[model samples]
Target: MRIGLYPGTFDPITHGHIDIIRRASVMVDRLVIGVAINRDKGPLFSLDERVAMLTDECRTLSEQTGVDIVVHPFENLLIDCAQDVGAKIIVRGLRAVADFEYEFQMVGMNRALNDQIETVFLMAEARHQAIASKLVKEIARLGGDVSKFVTPPVHAALRAKFS
Candidate 1:
């Protein structure tokens, strides 16, 4: 069974993320959404909260798309996490050229670490390309609306945490 890993902070999973997950699901037998722990950027939601939100968001896709979704919180290296989960592919969403530069470097390093694994970049839908967690958090923190960008559960969680 081919497994893919989509790793990110996912402070709050957005519709764009859901779109990527849905698209990636069609390509892989199993997709592991790794909620990475980034010590650099203090997260808005706790690991448990992020996992809960991701789990809830993925449930609908699970039923509708028949993709086995696994939400795991990882503090170790991403390659290690991928290896642990038996992923032969790393799934990533490309918003623009800038994203490609960074993801390219990581992909190179991951390839060096494990030559068998490959990185697949999927272009984000034009409308969702601008919807990022940091941007959503900033907008919502200032009491602006973000209903269109993120899921309802993520919206609620952001409000509760930032408001």
Candidate 2:
């Protein structure tokens, strides 16, 4: 089976993420949403919370696409995580040139570590290109509407977190 891994903190899975997940699912037999357990980022949501949010968001997408979507939390190198999930492709969502620059370096480093795994970049839809989890959280914290950037469940989770 062609398994692909998409790794991210996913503090609160945004619409941008869902867009990528939906698109990526069709390209692989199984799409593993690797939720990173990066403590350095001080994520707004806990690992379990992030995993739960991703799981909830992806259930429908999985059903529609007929591609198995699994949420796997990892605290190790992304390449290692991919290996753990038997992923030969690493899927990444690109929003802008800035994101490309960072991802380029990451791809290089990951290749150096494991040349077998390939990284594929998917450009975010224009509408979702500007939506980010960090910005979503900031807007929610400041009492702004984030309905356009995230799904209802995630928006409710953010509201509950900040409330």
Q: Pick the candidate with the highest lDDT.
A: 2
The positional error of residue 162 in candidate 2, measured at the CA in angstroms, is 1.2
Model 1 is weakest, by summed lDDT over 10 consecutive residues, at 154-163
lDDT for each residue of candidate 1 in 1-163, tens digit (9 for 90 to 100): 9999999999788989999999999988899999998878898888888899999988889888998988888999899999999999899998999999999999889889998888999999999999898999999999999999998778888888876
Residues 59-78, model 2: lDDT tens digits:
99999999999999999999
Sequence-dependent TM-score of model 1: 0.97
Per-candidate clash tally = 0, 0
Candidate 1 Cα errors over 4 Å, as ranges? none
What is the clash tally of candidate 1? Answer: 0
TM per candidate comes to 0.97, 0.99
